[model samples]
Target: MSKLSPGEVERLKNSLKEKGYKLTPQRRAIVDIIIRNEGSHLTTEELYDLVKKDCPEIGLATVYRTIQLLEDLGVICKLDLDDGCGRYELVHQEENHQHHHLICKNCGKVLEVQADLLEGLENEIESKYDFKITNHSLKFYGICSECKNIKNK
Candidate 1:
């Protein structure tokens, strides 16, 4: 697993301080896990399991609270892919490159659409509707190639 860089860690710590939140060990551990697994889109339970390996004393309630706090602080993003559980990924502070998701309806596999597919749409919306597009998420649901092949077989 990748580790958080010193600069990234400090940035997160500073953000917590600005919000009147102390960087406790448990909170740091959770943040570390999230940053390390940057694109994993981990759920609360998934995070809890990974965090437990480092700090077995940490409780699920604590993880949930920490996740909520991080989300509130804009340190992490909450994603709902219609998977009946909230998934999370670190907020990319540097770039505005927000990727969309393609979900397989039959097998529930999530593939990341890496391109900024809505730039034109956002520009049009802003121009026509007088709205500012700060951020957006789009999910396309369909059968993946593997699932389609299975049906053909």
Candidate 2:
């Protein structure tokens, strides 16, 4: 994914504005951090600590608020990953966000793979069954590479 341009940020602000979500200082700062750091599947508390470097007065509640606002605006995607806490990541417009996760049950490592890997099966399922397919999310659970090796040793 590409780094966000100034134009994109402005567009996002305008988009949220229409939704009645004011681009407050805390919200912008939080969004800016997420944009600047790509590929960060961060938790709310982690984002709060990082955002504190720029705005120490920011509260955890504020972070949570911003995250929800962003998600509502389709600016970011939230993933549960079947973990204890939810994680957040900036959603790329180029990608359809149609993918599955490979999660290591032992160590909780989650990696995303494009949904195309299941293209034939998805198509077959739709043809053989009676369901309109709009979108889907799949998650495979297993032990991670390191954990597998550890067991062998």
Candidate 3:
């Protein structure tokens, strides 16, 4: 989790204000936690637990609402890894880059694949089908190295 710059914080605040949402203290705390744990891909329960440690008065419902708001505002992305739980991560405002995910079947550990592996494929698809590709979610599932080693042993 990397620290967010002051400008990034202001951008988020302004975006919220434009959407008729105030940067409430609780909401700010939630954003802070998400920003601090930037790539954690945390579930609602996990986020609630972490937020509760900081603001014990916060409720699960409030966390859920805040998460929905953030997602609607494009400040965070909701990820479905086919594990029966929705995960979330901050949307990198500066880059707006999309990365793929690798989920280990045995241990359920999710790893990020940062390379832009679909650029050529996207170009071909657009040219061949005459349809534009706006976004994509690509995930690969298999046993990770550690799990493979354990199975071998």
TM-scores, all candidates, are: 0.89, 0.81, 0.94
Which tens-of-lDDT digit does each residue in 51-77 have in candidate 1? 999999999999999999999988788
Q: Mind giving the per-residue lDDT tens digits that candidate 2 earns over 6-40? A: 88778788988898877888998898788766555
RMSD of each: 1.8, 2.5, 1.3
lDDT of 3 by residue, 1-153 (tens): 576689978888888999898888889888889988876789999999999999999999999999999999888889999988999988776643568999999998899987768889999999999998877889999999999999999
Cα-based lDDT for every prediction = 0.88, 0.80, 0.88
Instruction: Give residue 68's lDDT in candidate 1 (0 to 100).
Output: 98
Error of 1 at 78 (Å): 0.4
Per lDDT, what order, best first?
1, 3, 2
Candidate 2: residue pairs that collide: none
User: What is the full ranking by TM-score, best candidate first?
Assistant: 3, 1, 2
TM-score of model number 1: 0.89
Which residue runs of candidate 2 sit more than 4 Å off their true CA positions?
128-130
Q: Judged by TM-score, which candidate is best? A: 3
